[model samples]
Target chain A: MAKRLQRASETVFAPEDPEFQIAPMVDVLLVILLFFVSITSAETIKARPQSLRVLELPVAKDSKKKETSAGEVVINAGWEDGSGMLEVAEVSTSKFADPDRMRQFLRDAVKADPSLRALIRADRKVEYGFINQIMLVCTQEGISNITFAVVDKERQG
Target chain B: MAGGGGGGGEEGDYGFQIAPMVDIMFVLILFFMTAAMMKVSENELGIKAAGTPTASQEAQPAEIQLRIDADGTVSFNDRVIGSPIDDSLAALRSRLKEAIDLFGEKQPVVIIPQSTVKHERVIEVLNACAAANVKNLTFGGGS
Candidate 1:
């Protein structure tokens, strides 16, 4: 009985049997790495620059799923806190200011890449007139491919 | 027994440490997590900004006029369809579907929104058109 007890103690106290196996840990780490990499890549297309102001986009239940192409130009329209003018792509344009410069910029961009699409990211609180004005400018610049950026209703929560 | 055990230990055994590998994996995991969290998903609704078709051009498809007032009221062809309080915009959807059925998918939809109308209300009208499978959408000044 004593010999059996000694053998059992030796088996219990064996140092070679590690508490954690490296193989399973490695497998888990690899799976996590793959998951994160895929998720990051999937969301990278919509990532906006930090310098751009955050606009509360309107929610649309039937908004189509579209990938913004490489040459697409994104225009952000929102109200500036201090100035009562509409902010279009970081430029402040009041109701009186002629949008000739903005239109010229868009014309030059479209001239360079005719296939370039225009995306308008308008704030939810913004008036519809502001968006219409921008759309008119795009049409005048010969850019027919215009899109409005919005948030999916399901994702709003 | 000691000599035999010593000889056994000398057999084809190369020591490989796993601690450093685990540390490196942890660093990689941290980096990936940070990158994933920083990315955000952006969605878009396609709209074509083109001038009104002139009479010189080919026969244009039937055009449906939609209007939104500042108080979130939606109207179809000068007839008020739904109010802002209706979250689903059921009436607007049904009317737009009827228009789509009559004019087919090639029907042109022109949205005339008041200058004071909220952006959300405008999107609601656009969503109704999208649900009805109306592709050719145009934005026009208040009528």
Candidate 2:
């Protein structure tokens, strides 16, 4: 048994004919693929609520581009399909018709982080009056940092 | 994982299967390609919202008043700057650009749009302002 093992080691020189490691290579590819699949699923889940609103934002050719921040407060303004009423949302998927509720949410958000930015994602079809009300809430809350999300005309369809 | 690579190899016989590897690679490539197209980048235009009434008021400065009519007509300081529905607000952009070029970027602009006007119209006006480089912009015609 000892002589047989020594002869096997001598014949199986690692550098001479290294195995192509097909299994581990496949394992690495699978890991990468799984990572990407997870990322895509999470993104889809996160975007579902926002995409349900069907906001066709106006294309702005010269709107200053700013990156979305984690610390900022987002206010989505859109029209409800069934009732044609104004809908507002904070971070949750739930949409509400009450501006007062949005006001309260903004107030608390401001209280939590005074420097938090309020990003408005209003549908282009919605009347300016509704958006004005949101601006008023921001003003009342003393949270002056505001941003409007628009589709960039430079990258338009 | 083992089933995908599960075919046990015989003694000294490699069990590498190009078929499954090729299948997963194709699926991953297709998913990635589609994912790349799924993202829509949103650009932001920033402005300072009105301060709380209790906050100290800014000192009175020269303010330019802009009004958007229900018909999408925009007037700058009561002067007709052409309707966006007709001219893409080209005239407005030029006038604002000329003013910014002359006075400075600090020139404040306040837009007062009719309550019934579509927000698209307002954004069009805002887009023109951005093109013309209006630095200080306020909505609702307030100080």
Number of the top-ranking candidate, with DockQ as the measure: 1
Model 2, span B1-143: residue lDDT tens:
32355466677576767757657675885687576456555677877665424244656447788898888888889887876565368888888888788778767788888876777888888888889988778786421
Interface RMS for model 2: 4.2
lDDT, candidate 2, A1-157, per-residue tens: 9999988998886457565676676677777777667656653121323434667777787887565566676677776652223344453456766566767777788788888887777777778777777777778876777788787653334
Which tens-of-lDDT digit does each residue in B1-143 have in candidate 1?
Answer: 00111122366664555666677778888999987665445677787775745455656666778888888887788898878787678887888788788878677889888987877788878888888888878887764
Per-candidate DockQ vs. reference: 0.42, 0.37
The clash number for model 1 is 0
- Candidate 1 segments whose C-alpha is farther than 4 A from its true place: A1-29, A45-52, A81-98, A154-157, B1-40, B52-61
Worst 10 residues of 2 chain B by lDDT: B51-60
Report lDDT (Cα) of residue B16, candidate 2.
66
Model 2 regions more than 4 Å off:
A1-52, A81-93, A154-157, B1-39, B51-61, B141-143
lDDT of 2: 0.71
Query: What are the TM-scores, per candidate, against the unseen true structure?
Result: 0.69, 0.66
Encode model 1's per-residue lDDT on A45-127: one tens digit a residue.
Answer: 44342343567788786887775468777776664552213334423332322345477678878899998777877777777
What TM-score does the A-chain of candidate 1 achieve? 0.64
